[model samples]
Target: MKTTKILLAGMTALLLASCGTHKTLMEQKPAPGDTPRPAADSTSHKLSYVQHISDKALYQKNVVSNLTFTVNNGRKDITVPGILRMRKDEVVRLQLLIPILRSEIGRIEFTKDYVLFIDRIHKQYVKAGYNDVAFLRDNGISFYTLQALFWNQLFIPRQQRVSEADMSQFSVDTHRLEVDGSAKIVLRDGKMTYKWVIPALWDQIAHTAVSYTSPTHGTSELSWFYEDFRPFGSKQFPASQSVEIHTPAIGQRPAKTLKASFELDGFSDAGDWEPFTTPSDKYKKVSVEEILGKLMNF
Candidate 1:
């Protein structure tokens, strides 16, 4: 009887362990680091520390890199060789190519004035202002927001850049550091919330998430993860990055999530490529929705 009781106890422990592992795997929240620490003593001091970190991590200049770009839309996954070009505060362009031949297949560019997309495979293109794009219009996201995410910096909406004076708007939470030695800095504007997580022993941003909630439009969140840092100038740049966007179900559309991952081969400050591309007359001009649907389906 004692041996039977022992066997039952062992099975109960195994069941509990399995349940715990499943919970950890399914949790959407960022994991806390193993290290622990207390919150900062003063608010002003914390703000100053974040500002200093931001200033030191800034990378300004034209950058070019060859990257592996992968996009997953829950149902399907596709990856292709690509090139990333950024002309500081001017434009960000991504060109995806056919794997072996290295021929261009698609291009997406973001500039201060407009967003441009070229579907070389279909000979279609989309050139429109942010307000004209449904996703951008609904989320209140602008070119500057995209710029900040790519550059790994903080930003304020509707503004071209976040200035020193704007640093006061952000709040820092150090309590999590006690659990894992990482810190979370947050800024809230109306219904939009922006959060950046800095890992322990690192000055650069390890992750960033922007979330928007609205009664009429439902809710959405964009999370960006940075890893594989490499030296650029005097600062470290993320050589690998991934972005995931989650949108709540709206009517019959149902819920949807889109994820994109980029692994850069190398970094450069070269500015050889043209910053803008004007679609040729042979390409048909399509609605943003049509072009996006085709790209997503690809």
Candidate 2:
């Protein structure tokens, strides 16, 4: 039971850490005499760059991968073997297994309608809508935001997906190319700011950072880094990824930060498994707050 709680708590930390805000961590300004000249000095050039980046989204209908999931939530670090499965616009599921034995221990599933979390060892679960999750509700994060991060694509908040017309909302900067041969794309929506770093030579997104500020709750940030590109379909996919979140203190809660890293052995587009899971009667359902309280106290 103790081990089960710790594992679940670690997973919760990762989920919560995925949706937050931070001050810009990377410098967006070009260094003196180091700015890379734009491909052309016209609006069409900027639009072309945005179109190129937007086109990088993988068109696969299903993706599956074997991964090593690691999380550090201030107190301790836990690493385990996991499986990640995703079906475009349908669901994203992650199953964590017991090492060596490879028995299922826990799983978290995000669908278009709700989020489901299961603890196989305890036969317990939590199912809630996006609004029912405090962190997600307060931060304006939804299923699509997570989907964008996991799929490594550009996104506009409160939208199901980014469209060709929406691409205009994002501004591309070539100044950073001189610094690291990467272009920076930025978008601002209300209090939230998003930035993506992409290598100039390729259209793939290498890093993403989202920051939010609130006069009442302070500021928080979520940073996702991607590496180790491998061929997938007609495009390249990142096999190594890491997420870092820093959230400001709210009420009695002190400011907190957590990091979750995922290293995938490889990628697959097979879709043999079911996309949804229905918990049997043997499993007990719990409230989101109940789970969040337990994880926060951990």
Candidate 3:
């Protein structure tokens, strides 16, 4: 189990996969005893209770660091140190490091046109567009969905793109749920539901859940949960976050899942991000099939 966990976590090559510090924002806590926080953003103010959620411009660009990264699926549990820097419509770059030696074990860079994953220790990498990867070519995975998830904004599947107007039209059979004193906004549309709630004094989205179903591929679920809200420049960002993805069994194949959790020890836009450098001729380049097969064998 441990060995399999290592390989699965390390090969998470596709593990499909926020902050703070304003005095006015920190004035109140999302929950009692928590620090104070700035009032809601201008965008959040425009929408009603249910409308505030689907705010696409939820945040501007920012970098985050000092994190403990982990990936688990009951069978494997692996954790490491990591860092991330992302800007909406620009890029999302991440690196996982070895603790004691502070050596970088892996890194993945995402851009509008492409996604790159590199195994620094082994010098293997995957560089391709979502369409280039046959497995995810049909899945509701895209630069926009990722951008929304990391930016802490609401997202809907297969809607041309992420925008405030598009979301406004997403009103289907909608409803709400009050859990633990917080109202969870649930919007059910066609074979999916988008649900979330404001955590405390902070105004932005703290959590998002997305479930999707297809007759041919079975059911898949993805969620992002936040914690450890801390002050950034003028806003508070969740310092700790957990992202989960699950795909149920289809046909004869078994189900698969990946859970990744991370905490931010550092948050700043101090580093540079670039596309993964093309490997030298000495390295062999393989197709997505080759990469997936190798990962399974690992």
Prediction RMSDs, each to the true structure: 12.9, 4.2, 7.0
Q: Clash totals for all models, in order?
A: 3, 4, 19
lDDT (CA) per prediction: 0.69, 0.80, 0.58
**Candidates sorted on lDDT, descending:** 2, 1, 3
Best candidate per lDDT, number? 2
Clash count, candidate 3: 19
* Candidate 2 RMSD computed on C-alpha atoms after optimal superposition onto the true structure: 4.2
User: Residue pairs in steric clash, candidate 2?
Assistant: 21-220, 21-221, 22-220, 22-221
Model 1 CA deviation exceeding 4 Å by range: 1-39, 292-298
Q: What tens-digit string does per-residue lDDT give for candidate 2 at 1-298?
A: 6765676787777776675453233322222233233463456777777777777788899989998998887877788998999999999999998889988899999998899999888889999998887667776888899998998898998799888788789887756765766778899987888998865455567789998888898778889988776779987777888888888888999988888888988789998999999998999998888888787776
**All candidates: TM-score:** 0.83, 0.90, 0.76
The residue ranges of model 3 lying beyond 4 angstroms of the native Cα positions read 1-14, 17-47, 54-59, 156-164, 172-181, 185-192, 199-202, 271-282
Candidate 2 residue spans exceeding 4 A from truth = 1-4, 20-41, 177-181, 200-202
Q: For candidate 2, which ten residues in a row score worst on lDDT?
A: 26-35
| Model 1, span 147-175: residue lDDT tens | 87888887777788777888888888878
Alpha-carbon error at 242 in model 3, in Å?
Answer: 0.9
